[model samples]
Target: MLGYQVPSPDEAMLIAGGKNKGSTPFRVVTGHGAFVLPFFRKARFLTLSMMESEVDERCVTRQGIALNVRAVIAFKVGTDEASIVAAGQRFLSDQDQMSVLTGRIFAGHLRSIIGSMTVEEIVTERQKLATEVLDGSKEEMARIGLGVDALQIQSIDDGDLGYIAAMSAPHTAAIQQAAQISQSQARQAAAEAEQESQRAQAEYARQTAIVQAQYKAEVDQAQASAGQAGPLAAAKAQREVLAMQTELAQRNAELRQQQLVAEVVKPAEADAEKTRVLAKADAERMRIQAEAAASHNRVALDRMLIDQLPLIVREAAAGLNGANVNILNGASGLSEMAASLVGQGLTIFDSIRGNLNGSSAEDAGEPDAPEPERPQLGDGAHPRPD
Candidate 1:
């Protein structure tokens, strides 16, 4: 353990006083342990870790503008044996000098690269400038047993010249205008969003109000219907009752009219007809009775006239007897006077019978009978006794 040595993961062990293998002054042992006699061999350690170097230099651009350029380089010692041997031989005594030497080397390259480019290229194309610087210094850094991982240009400016600022003026102005436009657009979009939110809220409120109004209207209508329900029902019932009463009254009136026709009008008509029939029969009977009476009276009157005819004849003859009695042909004259007296008596009898019969016929409402013919006597005819 005393004569054996091990190197750290980020370091290389260099044996300087041993028998070396290649055309190098040290034995580079990496990633393992080795045996070293303490008095016979001299060993040292070289770091293989990552290193950072800063380069800040003033350089002239292709446009004759002097610019201060600052840059950073990330480098490390190489992993191979030749690279280890080279790094150990150079930096074995002082390992911190690696970063210094790397910084100086990159500074020279940075100045040379920046001189070939314009200030615009140096400002805008910083990656290109770094890449070219890295590429130009690649072989030289490798000879010094260093490998570059990356190169970054930190800043580039013209000191008191304002050339970079003057050159970037248009782009800066364009960028500011673009920024202002973006801000205005953002504000406009925010305002539009706020208006849309307000509109949505208003619409929601309006819809809610409409729904509430409809609900209230429906409720009011329902309540009003409920309120009118009893009155409407009562009105309907009253109408039905009135209609029934009216129908009953009409039926009663019709029944009364029928009863009057049966009890009063029909009986009256029957009584009137019976009375008329009785009156008619009495008138017929009275007419027949009068006709019979008139016939009887006429017969009696005829009999009485017959009885008085002889007397009338006698009287006439007597009257004649008392009158002037001169007879013209003696027996014939007497006979003629007696015949005239009988004829006159007969005429008188007929007249009396006709008058009585006419009176009787008039009383009986019958037509008068015809009078009989009177007896006629000749002037000189004798009266017959028969």
Candidate 2:
């Protein structure tokens, strides 16, 4: 086995590719004969063609045909996948001009193709598009027997999507600020309203208290006035009585004059009031008696109607007979025939008074008015009942 030198993956790959890509590898062991064994057991299956070494014609690769170039390539190859391999299998040597040039051409093509692509499309559809690229590139990369040893999608530059992200930052901040401002305003308004509501409640309570106090004051004033009212009124009466006594002493003639009011004037007035009440009562009694007579007369009139009703029926019957309805259809046609009968029967009444007595019939049984009231005797409070 060749000496194993653990290093960075790039360095290890450099050692794997026979220190390819200008990677200066550290030698792990010194020379007993200073020979590289070309330990590429993993590359045993590949078809290798090597040029004859003029110094050593027998120095052919394990699966090699001799070629003009055999110089080792130093490389730390990068790819779209894992570790690198040596030239003719996974890489090309520096002195293998055809292979190196072919590699450069293929690399330029790969770089161009990969560079042309969007990283999202490359990464998101990695398996499909990447495999397609790899497959399509295989023969081209192996044009000079320099097949790709490994591949890696090491660093994908998802180019400059920061513009979209950076642009959204301000918008997000503005939205958040607007939301916070709205929320703060709402909270502030709510708080202010709450405070105002509390103030209103307090004001209402204060006003209510004031009203209650005022009402109590009014009630107390009313009670105090009520308590003083009787004594105040009695004192006023005594004062008036004293004044009246003084006035009576000062005006004896006036006192005598006033006495006439109590005797003559008051008695006359009382007599006049009593007369007026008695007259009113007598008038009312006479009116009631007249109403009673009228009622009796109405009752007599109603009684007379019973006898007259038969006479009316007889006259209507004769008229209906003249119409022949009573003989032909009888009372069944009475409603129609009765009008004719009534017209003819009216002439019978005409022999006595006819419609000329219609007015007198209305006046009959009406009561004569009562005689006017005469004087009587009573107090003036109300008229006496009958």
Candidate 3:
């Protein structure tokens, strides 16, 4: 850069090289190996227009104890050094004049960083301030033949303690939550274990109680049985004794029954036998008397026959030999037959009379009147008593 004052856009100046004897729109001055110049448009293009040209640029803060402003802006016109020199030389030949223009163009960026508080922020973040200033300066100066590609804010010295602390808060909360989760899991596990332990204790207590109750019940049962053992044994023994006595009594009664059968029953059976024989003999005697009475009944039939004899004889004479048997012949025939029947009838009457007085005879012991002898029935002697 050359030390010179920037001129207005309408300013015209002479070229440093003596090759041109007249003034141009931009003035140029020669530097050590390059030329500095000013133009209406950037990149040394001196088109008579008021527009700023496009290019790439960068800026850097000066490294001393001053404002944290951009003190330098590196311009990169698209063309190479020869093109840059040619573009500058076409309108401006004085390099000092071109430097003045370039300085004035970039000066506004330095002014933007001039506030005392701007330095306060710049002091906190100089690199960021420089990066912004460089960008603005490059654009401001592009109208004066300078351009740039990109600008970057390098490392900043701003303090991040609060941000760092804020960033750690979530991690701290997460760690606390993890600890809480771990503690909850442990507590839950412990609770489960306690519940299991309680269940085990309850089970053990229940089993122990059951065993004790069973033992107590068994002991009570055994005691009750022991208390009843003597009385039950004695009662059973008494029942057995009673049964033996009853059996002996039954056996004695059976013996007595057999003896009675032999003595009283045997005699009674003999007497019944004698009574049956006597009753049979009496029945036979009564049957004989009834037959005798029936025979006496034939007396009336004989009388009827006697009266019917003539007709009987006539019937007989017609049927048999005309001659008949002799009546009243010999000792007995029909006449004797009839007479014997009458006499037998009378004897039955006398027998009945004797029967009527039968039991009185033994009471009085009187002699019974004898029956008159019936006339002999065609016999010389009456029939003897049957």
Candidate 4:
């Protein structure tokens, strides 16, 4: 085991004094096995891993102003055959000096790149400065068997000059003025809006008060009108009651007049009519009775005179026998004389009956003659006999 040698992942084995010796002496070994014998072969470790170096230097800009530039460079031992041989030849014995050599190499490139650029370009475009340094240092780094992974400009300072702040003063002042103007406009608009809101509130309050007053006035007027209604209605009721009583009294008077006509005046008039009719009927009855009596008397007297007529006729016949009166148609002539005498007696009896009836009717207190009919005033007045 003491005679054997091996290399790690970050190491490349450069074997010398063996079968691989004297040609280029570079053997890349990784993870486990670059086997070598201690007496007959030799192995050197060359790191292929990344390494970092800081570049800080004061360099003059294109304007001849000195600027302090700080940057970082990430680099590694190259993986190619030629680059590995070169790095193995150079740093295989002193691996710790790689960072020192890289820093020096990038510092020179940074100075050269800064000398070609202005302070504004260096401050504003840091990446451009880094890129220019990286490109300029590429060939020199490759010659030393190194490859750059990245280069970053960490910071740049002009030492107390305040050149960047002085350059931005005009733009910063313009921005602040714009912000102040926006704030002032916003406050003015808010004040105007608040004033308009207060005016509207006052107008609304005025209109509301007017409306409420009008409503209260109307309510009081209505209350007053309501209070006066009771007496007016009472007076109207009294007038209506008087009018009804007057109309009732008039109606009662008319009823009483109708009752008088029906019960008292009508009956009195009917009774008077009935009395007149009865008196006239009584007169007619009396007249008729008296006339009938006179007719009976005249008939009796006529019958007595008819009995003496026979005697008278007999006496005349005797007288005629003594005188010897000559008569042609003798029996016929006597019969004719007798018939003439009878007719004379009948005529005298009729005249005496008429005269006696008139005298008797007058003596009996009968009316001269009653009218044929009487006008009836009412049916209820007349009570006919059953």
Report, for every candidate in turn, its global Cα lDDT versus the true structure.
Answer: 0.87, 0.48, 0.53, 0.77
Prediction-by-prediction clash tally:
0, 20, 15, 0
lDDT for model 4: 0.77
Superposition-based RMSD of candidate 3 using all C-alpha atoms, in angstroms: 23.3
lDDT tens digits, residues 1-386, model 2? 45433333222222232443343232221112123446551211111333211110111112231111112222223332222233323433343454445444434434444444443444444454435545666766544334444333333322353532454578879999999999999999999999999999999999999999999999999999989998999999999999998988879978788999998999999999999999999999987886676567655654565446559758657543434222244454444345445544444434333232343445554434333332332222221123
Q: Which candidate is the best by TM-score?
A: 1
TM-scores of all models? 0.52, 0.24, 0.27, 0.49
Cα deviation at 130, candidate 4, in Å, is 1.1
Error of 2 at 321 (Å): 3.4
Candidate 3, residue 212: how far the Cα is off, in Å: 1.4
Cα lDDT of model 3 overall?
Answer: 0.53
Of 3 and 4, which scores higher on TM-score? 4
lDDT of 1 by residue, 1-386 (tens): 89899999999998878777678877888899999998899788999999999888988988888888888899999999888878877887898899999999999998889889987777888889988999999999999899999998888778888777878888889999999999999999999999999999999999999999999999999999989897998999999999999999999999999999999999999999999999999999997887777778778888989999999988877765545555566787777666777879988887888788787777767788887776576556544443
- State which candidate, 2 or 4, has the greater lDDT: 4
- Alpha-carbon error at 150 in model 1, in Å? 2.2
lDDT, candidate 2, at 157 = 29
